[model samples]
Target chain A: MKLTTIAFDADDTLWHNERFFTLTQDRFADLLSAYTERDHLDERLLSAEKRNIGHYGYGIKGFVLSMVETAIEVTEEKVPAHVIREILDMGRDMLRHPIELLPHARDAVVAMAKSHHRVVLVTKGDLLDQERKLSESSLRDHFDAVEIVSEKTPDIYRRIFAEHGDGSERSMMVGNSMKSDVLPAIEAGAWGVHVPFDLAWALEHAEAPEGHDRFRVLDNLGQLAELVGEIG
Target chain B: MKLTTIAFDADDTLWHNERFFTLTQDRFADLLSAYTERDHLDERLLSAEKRNIGHYGYGIKGFVLSMVETAIEVTEEKVPAHVIREILDMGRDMLRHPIELLPHARDAVVAMAKSHHRVVLVTKGDLLDQERKLSESSLRDHFDAVEIVSEKTPDIYRRIFAEHGDGSERSMMVGNSMKSDVLPAIEAGAWGVHVPFDLAWALEHAEAPEGHDRFRVLDNLGQLAELVGEIG
Candidate 1:
């Protein structure tokens, strides 16, 4: 397959993301320790996130909102105003957190930029948060295009590929999430290259497509350029 | 003076948006009536919105967050958890709110769709919220493309017009906000048409361009098609 386009997922794929969420989640647990156990709070928060995803979509803001909702619910609507304020502060801190690029992220993007292939960042989250992260990441110039979507569906991958590159057949998507960045892209008739980040969010987990010819996995992003060359 | 592209802004430009915010603000004031005066609450909420715009960007979510922050601030952290829950519920209600298309919104879009020019929906707000509104509006099929941005600026307009249409010189942007939808668009070397909505957000208020050659204003969307035709 001639891969004329290489799309990368942001968040955990290019930079440290899920860890920040984990850190915030831990902080959330601490803030509510008096109201409920950590595990219960996590389950409720996750459930709230699942329920609210359709409404709020994905982002730090949604996560924080879910935490607040979960806090209110667990405390039986007795969650202190200061706890809510602290939760909001955590979200602000997350939004303002400096971008920390993962190893070889810049190199991989730079390689794709130098190559003939179109380099696009296909991420799903709050438009402003994604735009802010990308702007802060100092790697925006390496991309030919940026698509901050609400979700990564098969149809979305198909449309993005068709719009930014030759098509799905000539495109490859690289990222961390099996459910979001990999499987849907593979289903869209493109190469789905998984570069596993150490910490994965439970919502993003999925059974790996082991036997699919178009599916591939790498230990890290360092080998991405070589893999692209091999595929070409 | 060839107008090959006609771009329209979403939110109050094509639908009843500011009224909902006003309604939500009213509810918020009632919830905190014990703690602060209505005018004082409004002022605090506006200040919070302005300060938090950089972090939260724009949308019902941010607005709700700002309201929550204002509630906490106004009450000096004495606000009850039920009030916060009510505020969260208000945000959900706003997100789930049905689209109310403004006068002649459909006809104007249909008119532009039938014309030779490419029609594009250029909006700035929460991605999912805007998408939901567009989908619910049933006017999605009329436009050639949709651009939901974090903010609207001259550079953004130029890039959008160039990517989706011919370029800024051959494009015209129609919307409600003088700050967001008109002035920057005109600055980008495109025709900026203002369709004044009855209730305008204070943040979006701007002095109307009195005599700019490429600027025009209308009473409603009903006159948009005729205005475009006259310009051409």
Candidate 2:
């Protein structure tokens, strides 16, 4: 697999993103400790998010709103307004939280930059928040392009790979989500390398494309440079 | 000001966006009526939103979060959790609300396509929400390009006008906001046309450039086609 362009997923693949979501979620559960059990809150919130994804899409904004909705559902309309305020504060804090690059994310990209025609970051989230994170990641200079897309689907991958890379034959996507970063790229006829994250969002988890010719798995981003070297 | 490309702002300019926000705001005020006066709630919510924009940027998501925050502040942490839930419901309702096209938005764009090299829709908000709105507006085909940017700055205008249109010299930006749509485009050396909206967001309002050579004001979007024809 001679990859001419290497695309990275920004959230969990390159930086510590899911961990923030998890932390905020824990706080959300605690804020509603009076209304319901922690486990129940988590379960209900997940369902609300799944049900509401079509309407709200993905990202912290959607998550916070879902939490608000879930709070109402679980509390049976008796949740204190102050608790709602705390939930809003939790979302604000998450947004303000600094971008923490995962181990080896920088080195792997820097190494791949040597052989790749284009090193790109294709992330889907709030545009302003994503842009701010990219600049703060201090890795923007290494990328040939950055895409803040609404969703990651086979069609979007096909379009982006066609525009930014040489094409499927010479492009590869490296990321954490099997649902988003890997399967879509593989379906688009490009190579997909999945690097697992410990706290991957439940929504992002899916069975790996085990028999796909262009698919591979790495334990962490640290192995990326070597994988690219071999592939290149 | 002869123009090669014409751009329109999406929100209130193309469709009735701020109206949904206004309706939701009224509901939010009513939901928290026990905690604060409607006028005070409106004032506080607007102030909270303005304060939070730097962090959350813009959208229904930010506005909903601000309402939650204001509820807590007004109630001094005693607002009922059910009230918080109601606010979340308000946001969800807004998201699910049908698109209402502002008068003349379609005809104006149809008219511009006749005289311009490119007709573009430049909007800033949630990526998915904006895409959904554009498709729902059924105005997608009218635009040669759709820029869903994080923020509207002079630099962004310069870059987009250069790439999508001929350049700032031959590009014209027509929209509802003096701050976002008109000022930056004018500063970027493009012709700026302000079509005033009565319910324009407070954050979007600014002093008109009274004597700017290329700046023009229309009472409504109804005047846009004729104005574009005259300018072109």
Please compute DockQ, using alpha carbons, for every candidate against the native two-chain complex. Answer: 0.85, 0.71
DockQ of 2: 0.71
- Measured on C-alpha atoms, candidate 1 has an lDDT of 0.92
**All candidates: CA RMSD (Å):** 0.8, 2.1
What is the docking quality class of candidate 2? medium
lDDT of 1 by residue, A1-232 (tens): 5889999999989999999999999999999999899999899999999999999999988888888888889999898899999999999999999999999999999999998789999998889999999999999999999999988999999999999989999999999999999999999999999999999888899999999999999988899989999998
TM-score of chain B, per candidate? 0.98, 0.95
Per-model TM against the reference: 0.99, 0.94
Q: Residue B78 error for model 1, in Å?
A: 0.9
Q: Predicted candidate 1: interface RMSD?
A: 0.7
lDDT of 2 by residue, A38-75 (tens): 98998999999999898778888888888888988898
**In model 1, what are the clashing residue pairs, if there are any?**
none
Q: What is the lDDT of residue B106 in candidate 1?
A: 93
After superposition, the stretches of candidate 2 with alpha carbons farther than 4 Å from their true spots are B114-116
